[model samples]
Target: MAVTFVLAFGGSVLAQEQWVEFSSPRDGFRITFPGTPGIEDVTWTSQMGYALPARVFTVDRGREHYSVTVADYRGIEKLGIAKSQSCAPGAETCIGGQTRIVGPGYWKSDVHGAITYAVFMLLRRHGTPTGMTWNWAEQVEGTLLQFTNADQSRTSASIYMHDNRLYVIEGDVPKGTPEPELFKMSIGFIRPDGSGSNIYSHRFRISAACAAATLSASDRAPASRRPPGRVSGARTFPASPITFRSMARLPTAARFSRTTGRCQSCGGAGSSR
Candidate 1:
């Protein structure tokens, strides 16, 4: 029998780290790890007795274990895919349960409920979480949840839904490991077809620039000033909306970082909430 041991988080001590590239053609992701990772296929059984198939890639370095799990929801029904809402202009919120586009193609989803399901799954498998917090990243609009197990192992996970698949990138490290943030940011999706777009980032950048311009052109007194994005002058924006390349071509690193929440070298923000 294989011996099982709890890799205590408190005992993790850093040594010299060697970074390597690990790519998953089956799951469509590529990430940098301290060493070559081992792969395994795992089954996640839901509370309702449904089993979801998942592929996990894990690497163990000094005091940390870097892992990425890609879960397929093609036939699973527990976490239903989210449908786009067509809301009225004056309505506060729209009705849900519209027919969800179900297929192998990935769709952008609201990740709040999916994150909740993930938490439940974690609880079912590993007992109660010692601590938890929510986080968001630009472009993909994912939810990063941090958890500590009773075994003193710390798990920092970010869940993202793309193309009808759920991607969970997790780092389990000892409590005092340095640069945990960088470990979390090392995960990235590898496009098989090389065709993808960050629609949310594009919209956010355009709106942010428009809001800044409106604020700069505001004429009202401080006390009576209206909110930004309500400029009164004639302003012309591009008929063709901004693209990710344009966002990349922004003047400086700091300015681009502000828009996309990513560092120039690493390609994204490192910290989770």
Candidate 2:
């Protein structure tokens, strides 16, 4: 009976430690977790007051909680357009009209501010921030934050924006537990072709250059294989047209390399950190 008990306990420990890579192809991201996570669809309110579709994937191991929240800002431009059109004609609010509301690239601004907005939200939580810094994962720019809760628990989080999707990856554990570095560092971005990468040469900001590269690649593909009127791994702006001239105005360099399956600007040679 003693030997049987020992074997059962050992097996349980091993099971608890079994970590796996989980991917969300639709969301275009992947991460590691101790176990499969529960996914919940949610409506996330942006700092700009837009109600956006989002998903929260969570896993709980003993006292530790790990989660990844992905918020889609795809339809924000449409929302802005509607809001602008609904305003009374000639009113102060409608002074510049749709051009004022949606045209100044407000959607682009929203995407650029996503990571900072996510960090701002986290700062308002119960924990007191112990550290905050600009960080990167797989050469993708992000913000890293550490906090201490009232109950003395520790929380570590990384906020990243890729292809207009905001990702908030967090891990909360009991007091004195080592920082959840594994969970934080295991994030990878998936390409439209369903491939993922965790390596890059240098940190890169989310920019139109990368988006244009992706769209250009799709355009070059055979029509039958190409996704109609949409760029894979990117949100399509139907209400507001994106001119290639405007895309060129943004900083350039990143390109998806067909042979390497990595960002050419990222150098595509460095090992995953």
**Most lDDT-accurate candidate:** 2
Q: lDDT of each structure? A: 0.49, 0.69
> Per-residue lDDT for 11-48 in model 2, tens only?
98888778999999898899999988999999989866
- What is the Å distance of residue 114 in model 1 from its true position? 3.2
Candidate 1 error regions (>4 Å)? 1-16, 46-49, 76-112, 123-134, 194-273
- Residue 47, candidate 2: alpha-carbon lDDT: 69
Clashing pairs in 1: 9-174, 106-163, 106-164
- lDDT of candidate 1 over 1-273, digit per residue (tens): 223233433233222255766777667666777777888999854333336788888887756878887876545432432212333443322223222322111121222244456666665665346555555443454666666667666777676665445677778787655535566666565566543333323111224453343223332324234222321225322111123323322332222123223223323322111
Cα misplacement distance, residue 193 of candidate 1 (Å)? 3.7
Scored by lDDT, model 1 comes in at 0.49
Superposition error at 161 for model 2 (Å) = 0.5
Model 2: what TM-score? Answer: 0.68
RMSD of 2: 11.2
Q: Give the Å error, residue 200, model 1.
A: 6.7
The alpha-carbon deviation from the true structure for residue 220 of candidate 2, after best TM-score superposition, in angstroms, is 20
Q: Looking at candidate 2, what is the lDDT of residue 222?
A: 63
